[model samples]
Target: MTFDDPAVADELILPNFNYLGYLAQGSNVAENRINGAFARLLTPTLAFTIDSSWVHQNWPTGRTSGFDKTNIGLKYEAFRDSRHEALVSVALAWGVGHSGADAPDTIQPGIFFGRGFGDLPDSVSWLRPFAITGSVIDEVPIGSGGMALAPNATTGRFDTVLSPAVETLHWGFSMQYSSLYLTKRFDGGPPKDEPLNQFVPLVEFRFDSPRGQNTAATANPGFAYVAVTWQVAAEAIIPLNRAGGTGPGFRAQLLLFLDDLMPALFGKPLLSDRPAHSQIAW
Candidate 1:
């Protein structure tokens, strides 16, 4: 499950060594898959990501399937402000074409932004715990092209080449209510017995609009429990329309902070030996 942090534009997540994996079975696609991803910081403001998946699928024609191509991306923090808990970033992702990597090759460029509501007034302090994060991406095909048209029904003769594939735009929006904000920035302290104080409840919406194709969208509601070294989350995936899916799906994640586990390695650049100045804070 995913909840975009309101301060997501801040890219503060870069400091953590995070790994999340999920298993999914789809009603509309007739497939079962396992997907996993990891993100690591390469520098103070740069990060790299690796994502892979295994899929078992059955097409309408009774065809079987296997693993998908691996995916990788690099992101850079373009702007940040610790005082505001805000950040802006840009990233480029690619589907690596290799054996067992059976998905179409593509390149996606994405931009992200997020901000918290810690600057609100006392009258509306309740809403001050809320924050929002958003992203926009453009999907561009790289190598899946030069396709032939269907053969004539009667003569079975090959036709002309198929038209070039169209591009698509994807967007995501997430709203989060941070318990950390409630206790730290709010006027009153939290109830000592409050079990959910560290849990951030959030909802996310994702949309895909393809040129010359039906659009797809999904809404996900979930909660994330933030901790000193890790976090866990689960959400219900609700399709927005038939194009999105026939029914709901599900998502879950276990994210780890590498710096917490291996401070010397994950806390600094792997390519460097110099001592860095990053440290944890309460």
Candidate 2:
């Protein structure tokens, strides 16, 4: 449910703060990122989303800070089989050109899916609490917008040049074990109200592969505590190779389930008459 969800929007917002400390060019560097997502359901199986972020980095010699490009998108649940706990979705996101950091405008088309094993037979009841979610997006640049610095021949200065932006394939998946499902659906050892029942332990793996570059990958191991109207989660970011990072880092988020927090306002779709409660499981 972290990369992206196949379920229709249950109106929500997530404010996230990420920190990264690593070695860059033999110098220690630290980066802080503030980002969030605002999503709202438009129909029983359709939703709108906006994602943005700002980042600040500290280096040994100086510092740099700026806003990353923003993304606006639409997601549609293409298929679902509640009986089997499977769901699939398609999405198209547009990155605003020059929105920030001079990032090139891009069109990202993606597929998202989720599957829960809750419908398994009694023999595998233990695996019933497990779930998997994943996403695959292709980033296609609209035009050349890459920026680079070049030495000036006439003057002892540097000139900024624009180059072709690289296309990338972004993909990731998360494997989760929901204690909440265990307590609610089966006669488990722990009571429904047990503190551990609120936790969803998960591990997320992410990869970014450029058209002509080596792929960068990382694994994030974490857990999320689910509540009636809110959730809190954290993860340890572990680089899988040199292309990913030089050291470990971590990220955390606070998610607000607006539909649960204020049902009167978000209990129904803005463009449809379907009840908001019709949303599929995450």
Best lDDT among the predictions, by candidate number: 2
- Per-residue lDDT tens digits for candidate 2, residues 1-282, read 337767666645456887878632233568888888888889877889889889887755556678888999998889988778889999999999878767689999999988988789999887888899999999999987767444455764556677678899999999988776655544433355566536888999998888987788889999898777788899998878877778888889988878878888888878988775443343
lDDT tens per residue, model 1, 1-282: 332221211122322221212112233235555666666666666667766666654433343445666768887778776456576778888967553543357788888888877767889888777888888889887765434233344654435555465578888898888776645444433346555546788888988888887777878898888665667777777877766776766767666667666676576654444433332111
On a 0 to 1 TM-score scale, where does candidate 1 land against the true structure?
A: 0.75
lDDT of 2 at 117: 88
Question: What's the lDDT of the predicted structure labeled candidate 2?
Answer: 0.78
Report RMSD (Å) for each prediction in the order shown. 6.7, 3.8
Candidate 1 backbone collisions, by pair: 6-132, 9-87, 9-88, 9-114, 10-87, 17-258, 69-101
Question: How well does model 1 score by local distance difference test?
Answer: 0.61
The positional error of residue 27 in candidate 1, measured at the CA in angstroms, is: 8.1
Q: List the candidates' TM-scores in order.
A: 0.75, 0.88
lDDT of 2 at 258: 82
